[model samples]
Target: MTLLDNLLFSLSTTLPILLWLAGGHALKRTNRLSDAFIHDANRLVFTWCLPTLLFLNTARSSIVDSWQGDLIGYAAIFTLASIIVLWLITPLFTTDRSRRGVFVQGAYRGNMGIIGLAMVVNAFGTEVIPLASLYLAFITLIYNLAAIVVLQAGQTRLSPLKLVSQLFRNPLIIGVLLGLLWSITGWDLPGLANSTLQGLADLTLPVALICVGASLQFQSLRNNRYLVMIASGFKLIVIPVLAVGIAYLLGFRAEALGILFLMMASPTAAASFVMARAMTPWGELAAEIIVVTTFFSLLTTTLGLFMLRSLGWV
Candidate 1:
């Protein structure tokens, strides 16, 4: 298939899920569902469904021959570069120590776990699965470090070592580590084991998207509109432009270029709120950015695919 055809197919596949999320928001607005219901859905998806999906997707892939160290290096450098940019820009936007962490987190982090991996898998193939796994690992590391620094920026009592320890205990990080070890060791799952994992993994995306829809509060957007827009702009526009330029300068081509663009273009991660809630006082702001950016990302991602194709990078 041509790049435009592939882009259309991918967009079609993604649209239904986006619509489902929008419908959930509509339902919540009409008071058809309670906040508690949305909260529980978010909990179920994050703590159970998403991790299962990540683990099964990573574990089932043939990683012995497919693990690309160079791709991992590119992803790592891209993540670090983005974090540095965020650090420089964060102070300009917020002086509230409590709010700085969320602002910076939303600015720098992309939804690599959900949207990023899905796009890579859709645009490239299972062969890119190891690359996605490696990307997730590096992204997680950078995000955690950035989160800690941002959260503790003005606090004399905060210890970086303590923050690092807390991050290591995060469920998503644990899932990634387990998946990586299983991938590197080439461990085979029996049929039953694989089936159970695949079943759980399959539920992750749809459930997570639905939960995202249900949890979105339009009211919060009204309060933090400027921050949300700025963060989203950085995520969908500036980050991808920088990443693509850097990827080209560094000699990445084809699928690697496509993957890098997709990663950089993804909406803010669903976990950003969780991290903000746990580590900062601006959890509500983080959620607002996630909801707003997710809505806007449909257009940006489509345009990104078209541009990449026209430029013959994909």
Candidate 2:
């Protein structure tokens, strides 16, 4: 396909997410949806809907077909490199030590579970769910742990038991583990049960996008404007370019390369806000990062995919 074709397709594929986000934002402005409702909706989606979606997709995907250890390892390398680089550069960027973790996590830890998967499914197909799931499982863990360490830097002491307990309580982690275990069993749920779960899983993406839109507080970015811009730039631009280089060096191509790109290029996750709020006082910065990364992702991802497709890489 031509470059324009790729751009159009990319935009079309991603428009729904943007629209849902806008709708949510509009609803919030009009006061049609109360803050309490938005909060509850976010909680519901994170705790139940997202988990169901992850478990359903992972359990159903074929492990043998999707196994790509090299791809997984390479992606891990990208994630770690991002974390370390951001952490090292923290001092140069900001003086607010607590918000430093928010910036670092914002730069590297992408919305792989939501935006990444959606983009991959648009570009490739459902055949890649298992591979994506594996990548998601690995990075989600890394992101969570790294965020905690950075957020806790020179502040409250981190207890090993608390870390373990938090990991256990994290719904996403539990969903990934259960999904992998169920995939191992290879036992299909009865039709009625399966369909019921599928129905629940189907609600994840749209609801997530809307909640993200609703959660956004534009005024939050005002206090930390420059910081938000720098962090969002890293997430949307620098990181994706670096990821492309790594994928090429690792000889990833076609859907593998594309998924890797999504892994890198996708927006800052809404979950970042959740984690920031729970772990630090930097929730405002985290929310702004989400706003900037997600809105700009529309353009960056479109151009990124177009370039990749033009070269026959995705």
Candidate 3:
């Protein structure tokens, strides 16, 4: 396909999600969704719905057979590189220690569970879900590790044992682990159970998107207007370009390269705002970053996909 064709396709896949976000925003403006309901929905999405989706997708995919050692190693390296870069930059530019972690997480904590899977399915189809799932499992764990460290830094003492315990206990991580192990056992879920899992999984993305939209605080946008631009630039533009360049050097191509780029380029996670609100006073800035990047990705993602396709990479 031509570059224009690629851009159109990318926008088609991305626009539906954006509309959901817009729908949520409109709902809140009309008082159809109260803040209390939005908060509860966010919690539900993070805790139960997301894990169910991850587990169901990973369970159905041939994760063991499609497992790529390079995929894991590159994902780890990319995630660490992102964390280190964002962290180092945080101290130089920001004076508020409280907001530093939020900024760092904003730049690196991607909305993979939403945008990543959508991009993968649009470009490659369900056959590629296993690769994305495997990569998601590793990258997400690293994201949590980095978030905890940065958010807790220069403040309370961290217990290594506690951190380790939390990592393993993370519902998303747990789901991925169980899904992979269950896939290995080669025991299919009963038809009824599979359909039930699928039903729950289907709820995750739409609800997550709406929750994200409803949670956005415009006050945060006004407060951190410039910072939002900076974070959006880095999150949707700079990091993806740099990370994808590295992937190219490593000989990743086509869907693997495209999916990796999606992992890098997608908007900041909506959940980051949830954590930022719960952890520090920086939730406002995190929320602002999410809003900016989510909108920015609509344009950048299309362009990025066109460029990748032109390079014969995706």
Candidate 4:
């Protein structure tokens, strides 16, 4: 597909997510959903809906043909490199040690599960689905580690190992591991099991988007506008450029390169805010980062896609 075609297609698929966010705002304004309701919806989507989607997709994937170890390796390397760059640049944006965690978390964590998957599927095809799943797996693993380190940087009371353990305990991570195991073993889920999973998975994207929209606190954005903008720049500009450069250096090209670039260009993950609220004091900051980055990602992603196409990467 041409760059413009890819951009338009991406925007088409993304419209649903943005619309869902808008719907949430309308619902809240109309008193159809209380703030508590939105909070519960967020928890449900993260802990249940999203995990189900990951598990179903991974379980149904063809292990022999779908497993892309090299792609996973590249994704992991790119994510790690991004985290390091964000860490290095953290001091430039903030001097408050407590807020540093929020800054770094917003800068590096990406919405790989939702935005990345949607973009890859739109630009590529179903064949890229398995690759996206693998990419998500690697990104989730790396993000958890980076999040813990950022969240606990100055907290002497929190052990890194303990934080790591807590991250693994997350249902989404468990689902990923289980799905990988099932795929590797070539086990078919029973009809009942598949139905249950599919049902739960169906709720993942839309509900998550709605909750994300409703959870957006305008107050947070007003309070931390500069930090939000910095986070957006890191997510949309810095990361994509770094990922493309790294992919080129590693001899990656064509669709693989394009996919990696889009993945890196995605906005801050919704899970980052959830994790922050559950484990740290920077959750609101993370939410602001997500909102600002997501809004700007439309432009940055289009520009990245155009550049990738011009360079014959897609």
Candidate 5:
């Protein structure tokens, strides 16, 4: 694809996200969406829609056939490593304990399920869906567990046993586990069941994004601009450059290398704000990071892809 092609692809993937975000913000500003409604909607997405989305994506892939062991390994290890790096470095930027967790989570998490998958399919076509789905399953599991740990550590001390217990009870983790079981057993969801699950899964992103928008407050964002930029920079630029550079050196090439870059470069997940709100008091900071990274990733992703194309790396 040409540079223009790259630009259009970036726009296509991110534009709808911005539009939905704008709609939510407009509703909130105009009093069309109330605080109580946003709260309930967030609870609904976090508890049900997001998990169903995970299950459907994971269950639909035949992991045995679609598995890319090296690709999946790289994605998982890099995600954990990024979280650790952020955890260590975040303290230098802020002394606020609550904001520390929110900042670190925002910096490392990506919208891989939605934005990353779209970019991969557009770049490599439908043949990759199975592999991408499997990748999403593993990485998302890591993202949720890691987010909880960090956020909890930032807020208060907890025993490892208790944390493990809580993690297992999490709806997102349960969904991924069930999906993996289905994939392993090679069971097909009966037609009606599959359609119903898909319908519920489809609501995840839109509702999550709208809730993110409604939660956003301009005053909070402006006040936290410095931290917001730092998180956005890591999400869109630093993490991708470092991770993709290492992947290239480690012999990833063509489609594998491209997927790595796109996933790494994808903006902060909309779910970050939901997760923050549900788990901590710093959801506003997470919302700011999401909005900023979602906007700037258009430029960073396009330029990075163009450069990789020119270098014949992908």
Candidate 6:
């Protein structure tokens, strides 16, 4: 595909997400979605809908068939590295402990399951979906665990036992674990159960995006604009460049390399805002970063893809 094609593809995947966000904002402006509604909706998305989505994705994928240890390993390592780097450096951006955690989470978490998978399939075709699915499954777990750690650390330190308990108790973590178990055991859900899960899974993205839109406060953006830029810079530019560059050096190429770049380059996960709002007082910071990176990722993702394609790296 030409650079123009890639650019258009990137825009196509992200534009609707932006529109969903805008739709929510419009509802808020018109008094259609109130604060209470948004809050309750976010809780619903995070607690049940998102977990169901995760469970279904992982359960449906044949992890054994699509297993790529090196690819998954690189993704997990770089994800943890990005989190550590951001956790250490985010204090430079703000002294507010909660805001620091939100920054770190925003800077590192990508919307891999949604935007990342869409671009991956478009670039490489359905042949790569299983690999992509496995990647999503493993990385989803990492993102949730790391997000909880950093977000909680911002509030106060906890014992290792307490942290582990917190992580396992999380619905997202449980969803991923149960899904992986189902995948491994080759258990098939009955038709009715499958349909029910599918219905809830389908609700995750749209609801999450709308909640993100409604929660976006101009005052928060105005107050935290600088921090938003910093988080966006890491998420959309620095992290992708560094992660993909390292993968190229490490001898990854073609679809493997392409997937790495696209996943890292996608944008901040909308779930970041939900998790933030649920756990911390800094959901606004997470929402701002998501909005900013998501908007600019259209250009950033295309340019990155074009460069890799031009250089014959992917």
TM per prediction: 0.84, 0.87, 0.88, 0.89, 0.99, 0.98
Clashing pairs in 2: none
TM-score of 6: 0.98
lDDT of each: 0.72, 0.77, 0.78, 0.76, 0.92, 0.92
Off by over 4 Å in 6: none
Candidate 4 residue lDDT tens string, 87-174: 7777788877788877888888888877888888877888888777777765776786677677777344567678777768887777
Q: What is the lDDT of residue 216 in candidate 5?
A: 92
lDDT of candidate 4 at residue 277, scale 0 to 100: 63
Model 3 over residues 245-298: C-alpha lDDT tens digits? 988998888888888887788888876876676577766688678777877787
Q: Write the per-residue lDDT of candidate 2 for residues 2-68, one digit (tens) a residue.
A: 6676667656656666788788778888898887886677677778887787677667755667778
Global fold similarity of model 2 (TM-score): 0.87
Relative to the true structure, candidate 4 reaches a TM of: 0.89
* lDDT, model 2, position 211: 66
Model 5 spans with C-alpha error above 4 angstroms: none
lDDT tens digits, residue span 189-273, model 5: 9999999999999999889889898889999998999999999989999999998899999999999999889888999998889
Compose the digit string of candidate 1's lDDT tens values, residues 30-95: 899886876676666656666676566566656656567776777777777777777677778766
Q: After superposition, how far is residue 130 of candidate 6 from its true place, in Å?
A: 0.4
Error of 5 at 36 (Å): 0.4
Q: Give the C-alpha lDDT of model 2.
A: 0.77
Root-mean-square deviation (CA) per prediction: 3.0, 2.6, 2.5, 2.4, 0.8, 0.9
Clashes of each: 1, 0, 0, 0, 0, 0
Off by over 4 Å in 2: 125-129, 145-155, 278-281, 311-314
